[model samples]
Target chain A: MNEYFSDLFSGAKSLLVGLSVTIREMFKPVVTVQYPREKLEITPNFRGHTELVKDPETGTHKCISCMMCQKECPSDCIRVKGEKREGVKGLALVSYSLDFTKCSLCGTCVEVCPTAALEYSQEYELAGYSSDEFRFDLLKRLEER
Target chain B: MTPEAAKQDKHTFVLNMGPQHPSTHGVMRVILEMDGEHILEPEPVLGYGHRIQEKMGEARPWPGFMPNTSRMDYLSAMIYNHGYVSLIERMTGIEVPRRAEFIRVITDELNRIQSHLLWLGAFLLDLGAFTPIMYTFDDREQILDILEDVTGSRLTYCYHRVGGVARDIDEKFVERTRAFIARLRSRFKPIYYDLVTSNIIFIKRVKDVVSFTPELARRYGLTGPPLRSTGISYDIRKNEPYSIYPEFDFEVPVGTKGDCLEVYNIRVAEMEQSLRIIEQALDRLPEGPFRNKIPRKVKLPQGDATFSVETARGELTYYLVSDGSDVPYRLKIRVPSFSNLSVLQELCRNMLLSDLVMSLGTLDLVIPEIDR
Candidate 1:
């Protein structure tokens, strides 16, 4: 009977010890941010989706239509079509579309681009009703920007 | 009685746990034969999360498979990247710069701690505690911030390359990491020990429950905390030193009894050891190029080589066969969760249903890794 009471008291003590930690934490400031209402700063290196970079001098995309990113992409989500004109020294990029649904966001396209035409956009809260809404045309996006 | 006859026994009924259950942690299904609350047999069904990663490895170019490695074990993605990158470097004889090696060790240890922290909270949640997950996630967010500053991804990081890492750590990263280390060190006693470890309820639930022998562990080829709980002390970092691990001094935590509580304690102790490794690696940060210049196109010799690294769970080994081509002829991954889960069939025999949950939780089975 004596041992049982001792065990009872020790068990109660342990329970209270655990409870105290939670009580102390209750007084501290909340750690989580209310998403949508309050957003934390996105790091500069945050990877979202691929975007086309504009060349300042050429006033167009830096893509020479080398097809390096298209060939190197593992997911086969990139489609590049280009045309060669009389005045243009290299193939002018006519269409560059990204099927974002199939993209793994691996950044292989960004790394393999020789002309530095591709970069990661900072858009994080991407949402849409249909998968087709995600298919991005780089030329159209560049023009819009 | 024959196996079929045993199923027809009046006292026994089969219980199916998880292809969708929360306690299984992933898409793992276990068919359990139970006589009331006691489990007679447990059979785990895998391949639910299988993406045929090996076939993908053979399909893509050697360098293109970097992203697939992280997908295999998303919890310890950085360590998986380290193993794959190290394997390629070994095959092609590419030298990694000194600073890159240090950064790899630091990031890998930080990732290890983060993985263990998640497992700790999830394991407790399995044992019927909800408060710890909130606390663990608080710590996890800090590590994610530190990792994102350099690796550029919150999860599934494709940060490692054949010769070195993708980016260099700045002064801000070092300061934040040091502050996090101090904060976590200070919270270990008050938060983990006082709240969870010393609580009588937790102790009673886990201690001496689902206890196994060292022979059982050896038969099942167990590794990581589960094997360490059996007092084997077999860590790939210590047994087979790789990378810059030999430069740091730390002890591998071992447990005398192979039980749920011991496994939990071993993981907690491991988090401390990882902190020590990170501190040492950061102190010896080298001054040099982060990456070495390699050929644009890489090809390996016509032989096969194997490389292993100690991940947060256990040892992850990548075996590749290259036929002097840019693409691998065959690639095989031996994940620790696969071997660790195999023991459940024998270990769960004649165990209480509740104890089975605790034991399975303590195994720390990341099902996607096993299925991969």
Candidate 2:
């Protein structure tokens, strides 16, 4: 009976010790980053969403209508409608749309792009109520930047 | 009658821990013979989920088949990316552009950090200390976000290509990764100290539970964190000095007593060193082409190269047997977990079932990688 009481006190002592440590930490500076009211600064290498990079020269998009990106995409999130125009020498991009629902962010297309016209952007907050909103068209991206 | 009774006592109950146990991580099975609760003898059975990874190197091409290699060790996928890309670049004798090397180093470090963070959470989870998982994952989420911005994948990222990286990172990625590293450095060490290190419950559970002498560690071909824990200062990136690692300033953390806690401390120290490496790599980052100029069709010379990389778990080796064909003759994977598990036969001799679990957990054994 005496031995049992000693064991009980030892257990109580350990529990008290743990509780004290936790209580002390509560007084320490909180490391929490309050979102919205206080936005945490993200790093430069943050991978967000994919975008079609525009050429500053023509003030238009620089995709070059290459179907390589569309074909190389593992998730097949990218869909392109490019055709050779009568006046334009290179293939003109009719439309390039990315289905965000289908995208896995593998970056295969970004790596395969020879023109360096497509790069990943850090705009991950693309959640929406409408399904159509997630179907991001490349032309829309051109206007945002 | 007495002689017959003595022989039956020698016959212990051997339980098979299987290619499908939840805690097994991969397809590894351990046949454990027990005298009641104590494990008498343990035999780790392997090769159930072996997928020929090395052979694909020859079948696909130098950099062409690099994507296939990433699946071997999913937790540290970027490290595999580093190994394959660096190896091909070395073979071609192409000087990786300064910017590309810097970015690669930074990404590799982040991947290491993220991998270790996950391991930290998982290790604690295995030990029944659940709170650290959330804290660790919060930090890991930041890393995933950073990696996703640049490499465009979170978990199993396949970023690096043969000559260099596929695309160049922008200013935003650099700034975000640096900030994330700073926050992680301050936040990480303290939580680890408080939760795992300071807590006597944790220390009592881990310290001296499973012991590994330095001599035993070398014999098993142990590399990376576990080897370092045994006071061996061998790192592939430092000793081999590949892809601008020589330029970076860092130290390898060695453990004094070769035990479970020592192994845990080694990982924590390595993560800090990786942060320093990332900072230096970023400071020295340059501007140039991310991809090296290589032909679309890469035909490597008819030769065999066995490569070893320091992954989160330990040294992962890929031996390629090329037969001058587009496909490989034979591929062999000598995963670190496989060698590390070899120590179990000795480690579990006089321990309880829980001790065995904690020992295995500390090893950070990846099942598929080991099986592969």
Candidate 3:
């Protein structure tokens, strides 16, 4: 009978100890941020999607259409089209399309760009109704910017 | 009744346990032959999460395979990144900066703590405790925030590069990490101990239940915490001493009895050790270039090298064969979960169905890691 009470006391003690943790935590502020209503504060290092950097002086994209990013891309998601303009020395950008569906966000494209044309945009809300929306024309986006 | 008639009269049924079950962790199906609540035999069915990653390795360049490593073990992706990069670094005899090595160790240990925390929560959730997971997630969110500040992604991080880390850590990263360590030590540790470990119901469910002997663990080739619970003290970090682990002073916590409770205790103890490693790494962090100047197209000489690292799950081995080309000739990944999950067939025989869940939870099998 004495042993039974000891067992009961120990069990209750353990139960109280466990409950104490939850009870203390109850006063702590809730960690959950209501999604859709509020968004997370993103860090500077967040890699969302690849974008073409616009040259401030030229008011045009810095992407010389070198095809370096296309070659460096692991997923084969990037496609660059460039044509030599009349009497122009280097290739001019026609369209630089990136398929967001296939891009793995490894940051290799940005790292490998010689002219520093590629940069990661902090656009996290990338959801769309159709797959076609994910295929980004970076040259056009740069023009809009 | 005759023996044949008695055998015919025996009632045994098969129950499918997963493929969509939350407790399975990922797309894993288990065929359990049972007589009432007792499991007679449990056959694990894999391959639902298989992406033929090895074939993809051959198709892409050396650095291209970095992103795929994280998908295999998403919980502890940094360790996988370390393993893959370390393998290639070994094959090519590239010099990784001292600072980079320390950074790798720090990030890997941080990743480990988060992985173990998630396991602690999920394991309890499997055992019908819901509140513990919420507390764990609160702790985990801090870890994710710290990791995302530098690594750029939360779950599937491709942080490590061929020679070193993709980016360098700043003063803020180090300061934040130290602050996190203090918070974890002062605030979180006691709560975890009091809430889960000291609880009588949790102890009653796990202690002395589903225990495995050292010989049985060895026979099944179990590594990591499961093997350590059997009192083998066989940690790849200590025994092998890869990267900067030799510099850190931490004890390899072992359990006397290889039970579910022991597994739980060892993982919790491991989190403390990981914190110690991280603190030491942060203190000893050197100043140097984070990454060496390497060619965009990595062309390796004809050779094969095998590198193994102690990930959160267990020993994750990467074997890379370079045939003097940008792409690998053959890349093989030997994941820990594949071997860890294999022991379930032997361990689960004649055990109660409810206890089987406890055993599975303790093993810490990540299904994508297994299927990959």
Candidate 4:
């Protein structure tokens, strides 16, 4: 009976200790970033969807349409097409589309690109009404940027 | 004992705990044979989160399967990524740079700390404590931010490659990691030990509630904290040193008894040891190329190889049989969670329903890894 009472008293004291810890913490600054009302800075290296890079001097898409990224994609999410064009050094990129619905964002395509023409977009709050909205045309997306 | 036969007994009845329950963590169902509030038998039903992960490994080229490894155990994704990359590097006989090895150790230990923090929160919540999860997640977010700065992904990172890591850590990363370590050390005594570990209610709820001998633990092939709680010092990092781990001076923390409370204490103690490892690696960061020059198409030699790493939960090994081709001929993943969950059958026999939840939570199971 004495041991039981002592156990009961210690348990009650410990419960109050826990309560005191929480009470002290409640007075500290809130760490939560209230979503929709506020936002935190996204890191520069954040892995978003794949996007086509633009050449600094030419102000056009840097993609040479080597087809390496499309071939290397594990999920077959990338599609690229190019044709021989007049006065161009290499085959001009015609179309580069990414089926973002299937893309795993593994960054394999970016790593395999020979000319460093591919990079991850900063568009993280991506929400779409239809599946077609996610099928991103890389050239057009670059032009818009 | 099957559920159908258990229903024939007048004193006992069948109870299905979850195909979707909070305590089970993910989608795991437990078929329980109950005699009132006391559990007679508990059999866990798996395969709910199976994604044909092993078959997927053989379907892709060796490097193409890198992203899939993170999905197996999403909590300790960096260690999983490191394991897969190391397996290929060993089979291909590629020598990784010295700097990349240190970075791998630092990131892997950080991953271990965050994984244990999440487990501590969830385990406490399982025992009716809600406040700790909030504090634990707050600390976990800091580690995620530091990792995302370098790996570029928060949860499922495919940052490691065949030769070495994809990116190098900057001085800013070192600064933030050091600061986070100091902050975590400061919080350990007040928040973790005093408020949780030493609490009489928490100790009473778990201590000596469900315990088994070390022989019984060995019979089940238990690996991580569950096995360590039985006073066995079997950490793969210490016993079988891999990467730069042999250079680091750290001790494998063990427990006196195999109980739920001891498992909890072991995980928390392991976090402190991981902090020591991270600190040592950060101070000794070397300067060199983070990656090596490997061929675009990596073909494994015609042989079999296996590599194991200690993840947050337990030991994870990748067994690969290569046919001198770019694609693996046969790949088998020996996950720790599978064997850890197997002991549930013997561990929870004739325990109360609430204590069963406590025991399961102490296992620190990630259901997707088990089902995989």
lDDT of 4 by residue, A1-145 (tens): 9999999999999989888889989999999999889999999999999888888999998888889998899888999999999998788999999999998889999999999998888878989799999999988888898
Off by over 4 Å in 2: A1-145, B1-11, B321-331
Estimate the TM-score for candidate 1: 0.97
Output the number of the DockQ-best candidate: 4
Candidate 2 lDDT over B183-210, as tens digits, reads: 8878754666755666666776789987
RMSD (CA, Å), candidate 2 to true, equals 5.8
Report the error of model 3 at residue B45, Å.
Answer: 0.3
DockQ values for all predictions? 0.78, 0.18, 0.78, 0.81
Q: Which stretches of candidate 3 lie over 4 Å from their true place?
A: A1-5, B1-8
lDDT of 2 at B358: 84
Residues B1-372 of candidate 1 have per-residue lDDT tens digits of 444455577668889998999889899999998877777799999999999999999987898888899998899999999999999999989999999999999999999999999999999999899998888999999999999988789989888888898888999999999999999999999998999999887898899987667899889899889999988999999999899999899999999999998999999999999999999988989889999889888888899999999999999999999888989999999999999999998888878888788878988998999999
**Worst ten in a row by lDDT for model 3 chain B:** B1-10
Q: Which stretches of candidate 4 lie over 4 Å from their true place?
A: B1-9
First chain TM-score, candidate 4 = 0.95
Q: Is the docking of candidate 1 incorrect, acceptable, medium or high quality?
A: medium
Tens digits of per-residue lDDT for model 3, B1-372: 432343367777789999998888889999998777888789999999988989999898888888999999999899999999988888888889999999899999999999999999999999999988987888888899999999888888899987789999999899999989998887555788788887887898898878788988889889889999999988889888789888889999998899999999999999999999999889889999999988656687798889999999888899988889978999999989888998999999888888998888999999988887
DockQ of 1: 0.78
Q: Is candidate 2 or candidate 4 better by TM-score?
A: 4
Clashes of 4: 0
